[model samples]
Target: MTPPGPCPRPLSRALIVAEARRIADEEGLGSLTVRRVARRLGTGQASLYRHITDRGQLLSLLAGDVALRLPLCADRGDPRERLRDHWLAAHDHLARHLWAARVIADGEHAVGTAAAFADGALGALAEAGLDPDDAARAHRVLWNLLLGHLLNAHPVGRTGTPRRHGDGSRSDFSWALSRVLDGVLAGQPAGGRWRLGR
Candidate 1:
């Protein structure tokens, strides 16, 4: 006899993305096949294909979805504080979703979602008196810095709780972030001439 149809309501594309993201989080991105996602969603591979064109498209959609979840320029007084908070939040999010970081590292831009993050960060740097070029370059530098630190600090295949390195109970994040900002600020022109030191 033929098998019964899938329960009642059909799964939405959002549900598929969520399930795929969960699988990536649990089993790493390598295991995120259409068949694997369909198995997780209790549906057939054809049903998944209806929403996602292929594995690449599905991963891009999932990355974009997760990118949207990142915090965006929330107020906390002081541009520096805001910037630090923003970077730390991004750091935390990427650390939790390491595969998302890998996708970004591989040069996958999620268009609208990722651009919002870049715009917000660069705007904050501009507000802090960085020139347009400096602001843009600073944004790129900070992103790379945070991603590199997190990836190295929390390597894959290691078990147990993650640890943050610092000296005498101080947060390395705070120290490193402050130093970066200070360096940027110091690079600003003084009396219409670029000055290296105060």
Candidate 2:
């Protein structure tokens, strides 16, 4: 069999990003490495450096790339449904790349796609009668719940394992997601009881 040829210089950056994303998706982000990506592309590490600076940059790009994959859409339903859809999309996206949740939580970098996502979410909340301040708070609440649930629902090395809920399981991620959305819509925090005062 002919040995794989080196990745051409022109396509190096795109190919590197694509390969990095594939590695993260199939083998979990923890497994993604510069060496692994280089090997997969049949290129030397130096070649990769021409396009990507380091592992941290590569991860940032990966996060941005993942964020860009989220489908942008205009508002269509009540704030509750819009928020639910946003949560589900974010959940599924992070679920696909378990490592991304950590990168995002760390606030390492911001990309246009992530910004757009934040805009959509805030727009929905604001349109639903939240002031800018309240919308921002709601956005934080939703994101926190998403990250926390994703971290627990998907453990390292357990990707693709179906969550068990039948037979009296205590952990129900879906149920919890719904309740969180409801709470957001009801003008309450995810884990807080309704109070008379602000």
Candidate 3:
């Protein structure tokens, strides 16, 4: 009888993602690469590729990890305020990870939690009286603004403490948000009880 070949290790993408997250959290997202992850895991880079297509895919996975914890869907309140709260919360969450915001900013990495968060945002805009197309466009615009703020606010290679919702930051964000809302919500009152995407 022919001898069996060497057994392959189990596919543990969760473990790979966890290690990648650690590297990103400690050093920064730029530091996270398949080579680094493989070296850290004591495996060949080819092995990692078997699970993750590329660094971009790994980034999406990392964003998915953070999105799972992101708090979306604000409680009942003035629709404008609710929308404001959701964005602030999102910013705070994305600020922690060096690259998650950058990755998710593409808006195509709609993994499980990310998609839910976006749905909540779209719903809020719809509730505020925007039609489906307008709500989608508005959401994308806000995402662009938010991702730009995050990428610029923190310098590259930054690590350590995540950003906090301090008074100045909060006030600034609130002001900016209000400006966009004023334009998008012009002549439209909040709390319209509308659904997203019709």
What C-alpha lDDT do the candidate models reach, one value each?
A: 0.74, 0.72, 0.76
Task: Give per-residue CA lDDT, model 3, range 109-196, as digits (tens).
Answer: 7678678788888988888888899999999988877776666664344355655433245455667888998898886765565454
Candidate 1 residue 47 C-alpha distance from true site, Å: 0.7
Best by lDDT: 3
Q: Which pairs, if any, clash in model 3?
A: none
C-alpha TM-score for every candidate: 0.78, 0.76, 0.70
Cα deviation of 194 in candidate 2 (Å)? 20
Which of 1 and 3 is ahead in TM-score? 1
Candidate that would win on TM-score: 1
Error of 2 at 158 (Å): 16
- Can you write out model 2's per-residue Cα lDDT over 1-198, one digit (the tens) per residue? 564577655546778889998988788777899998997788878888998899988988888888887644357766666676777776776677777777778887676677778888888777666678987987888778777776564345344656541211223445666786666567544333334464
Over 4 Å off in model 2, which ranges? 1-5, 153-171, 187-198
Clashing pairs in 2: none
What's the true lDDT of residue 163 in model 2? 54
Ranking of candidates on lDDT, top first: 3, 1, 2
Q: How accurate is candidate 3 locally (lDDT)?
A: 0.76
Model 3 segments more than 4 A misplaced = 1-11, 42-50, 105-113, 153-171, 190-198
Candidate 3 local lDDT, residue 13: 88
